[model samples]
Target: MIPLLFENLSIENQPVSMPLPNGITLTIKREDKNHRFVSGNKLRKLKYNIAQALTEGKDTILTFGGAYSNHIAATAAAGQAMGLKTIGVIRGDELATKIDVNPTLKFAKMCGMDFLFVSRSDYRYKHTPEFLEDLQKRYGSSVYIAPEGGTNTLAVKGCEEILTPNDAVFDVICTAVGTGGTISGLINASAPHQTVIGFPALKGEFLNKVINNYTNKTNWHLVHDYHFGGYAKVNEDLVTFLNVFNKNTHIPLDPIYVGKMIFAIFALANKGYFEPNTKILAIHTGGLQGIEGFNKERIKKHKSILDYEEKI
Candidate 1:
């Protein structure tokens, strides 16, 4: 057995110190430090999925995502660590030639995951029977498919462990939403006295429908205003916040997910969003490996550049 996934990675709740208008207390659930490769919510999402794959006697794992997807990189690393083959159905065909240039894909390639790059139009059909069948034909029957972002019932079950009995004291539990998998788990785990909020990384109305299909919990809410622009879209204000927050908390956040969620929480807190003495717990979903690509996009804005190790 690949031994890394068998380690008992501990989770910590670190308190955040900041000036707020109300008497609001904030803490972060440090899920990112769970593992070096399969860190953050990814580990939670993949825990049982990998078990199921093994129980089914699968020797290979197949999945889909964009070039910079944390899910793709995590899947590749996990499979290699677990002694299984992995295949990634990447969204852009042009990216096939840029594996060396893209940090996330570069790591996946290093872990021995093969790539099958497809056009954006073709990627939209990934869930359809025909597209999945084509994948099976190419990768063989030993493949176990992981839905993009590792969102599924098993993932939800793993994410529910994020909220311990101690978390019940917090009035609100917050996390960044990708495919609604992480939030769905939080919603399922939240106490009746608590509210779980999903701060989406992208602007969309369909998340409710997708999340609703997972859980029947009514204590959850989606905050749509914090996406900045859309998925992977970042502005100067956001870049500044990411840097400042890391400086203040010594915690790194990926621009796509955790960065935006933290920025929103601080802004709302400053604007008197929470009631006096409200307790909030922000989930630090890890995607720190994507900072290389994010900082490359900000090269024109920032004179300094961070290499891979330095970013980590």
Candidate 2:
């Protein structure tokens, strides 16, 4: 509401015409179109964070992320839109010189996010007081710090708003799990009969602890079957599926997050994972911003690139 960064964004529960089992149907919540830059869960996570920053009289916003992180790009644009100076603590120092070639970082730079590139080792201490103090020393302490991936209590509260009273009709709620904020919100707001499922973009059961901290609901479960070799990892098979999914549904998905979630959802639906007379709602948490970098990497590996977006 402060400077109105994302205005006129509302719930768009668009149904995807996927030919699944006869008893089940799949629909998608178009949270991705919330904003040009600050779209999807990124927008939800930033909603309260940005509001609090303004309420506290902070003039700057600082966040952490990887070179190709969607959070970094969204933060930079949201801060620019809200008239706040922004800083990005990038994980890889080497990417400092490659901003021209990196789409995510390039866009962040264009949005006026001051870049503080550090080595991977140094980035590991990003949570420690020493590291945070060093950052505050360089860029005033008034900077509202949104932790990497933008997953925090305030962010979780914003995400809980994703499901509306209309969404209660659906039997299952689904989302892609990154830092676990989106699904946690879904879990907290889910009806007793509604099951919340998370398709993790990264591997490991450690995210259970992260989600547990956000909500006390036990109706949610994470499907670890679709990591496809881990975070940011892709293959020819996945690319093939991505191309076909976009061609069929006309809903473009990012390689890292949405693609994996949709792929998993479709596979499960086809395999009769959903019982008869069941409805599944998946959150289209946008990350299409990373499509360019993902395609670039695919091209370098001599693999087919995902045709999710126009050439970068």
Candidate 3:
């Protein structure tokens, strides 16, 4: 059954059509198309976690996430597919009543995920032993805890499969970092000659520690200039860039992660960040599932939604 989720995995490399400076050739690994529900890094992160849960005879998987988190959606779907119950410990208690209006939560509910909503303050202690003990008491011993954003050693092991021998030709490999799991795996698998660049979706010096906890590789570095005021924060320029980028390359980028990474890559290339004839491969870690909920919020605010929302 685990193999079923990855049957459609397609990491096809597609070149971007753009007038970039320094003769840097940009190509994207379409890991987004890996699965329908458990796409991209989410799928990779969840693969071994699910298997381990089943191996340990766990009947349920418990995790944490926000309203439109890709990890939440993917975990719910994986649980449903594997016949395991899923418990989502959501960040906002208010979102408990708003699931019907929120695409990610609603979809998770449809996939048989039960939610335990908590206030943001309480969510900070989610990894604490006392909080975990409480969860065990509430959900019983049959529950397996999958960390928020699904970033654990097992998840990193799964993500290590993201790179292949064919990717060695690229001088640089790039990906968007959230909790730093995917990039950690990429760093481990990257060739010594390849510099792995990470564009964080949020601003924090803490990510270095997070990434360091997972791998000992020294070929990776994070660029802090393009988070756009932090996680899930978007402006008009980003939206316009996403639309125009999709129109030009026919590749849809989710605003939270990949969109920012792509924008940064373009801006950096234009600034001559790479030398001439350098080949760069960017990983498209899919969070496109959240675009619907995001555009819904934009519509309610009387703002422009992503123009390519319908295309991908």
Per-residue C-alpha lDDT of model 3 across residues 1-312, encoded as one tens digit per residue? 354665445589999997687678999999998887889999999998988887888999999999999999999998888888999999999998999989999999999999999999999999999999999999999999999999999999889999999999999999999998999999999999999999999988999999999989899899999999999999999999999988888899999999999999989888888889899999999999999988999999999888793465
Task: Identify the superior model by lDDT, candidate 2 or candidate 3.
Answer: 3
RMSD of each: 2.1, 1.6, 1.3
Clashing residue pairs found in predicted model 1:
none
- lDDT (10s digit) by residue, model 2, range 192-305: 999999999998999999999988889989999999999999877888998887777878888889888888987888787888868999999988899888878878978898
Ranked candidates, highest TM-score first: 3, 2, 1
Per-candidate total of colliding backbone pairs:
0, 0, 0
Q: Using lDDT, rank the candidates from best to worst.
A: 3, 2, 1
lDDT of each: 0.87, 0.88, 0.92
Which parts of model 1 have CA positions greater than 4 angstroms off? 1-7, 300-311
Clashing pairs in 2: none
Per-residue lDDT tens digits for candidate 1, residues 208-265, read 9999998998998888998988998877788777776777777788888998998898
Q: Give model 1's TM-score versus the native structure.
A: 0.95
Better of 1 and 3 by lDDT: 3
Candidate 2's error at 110, in angstroms?
A: 0.5
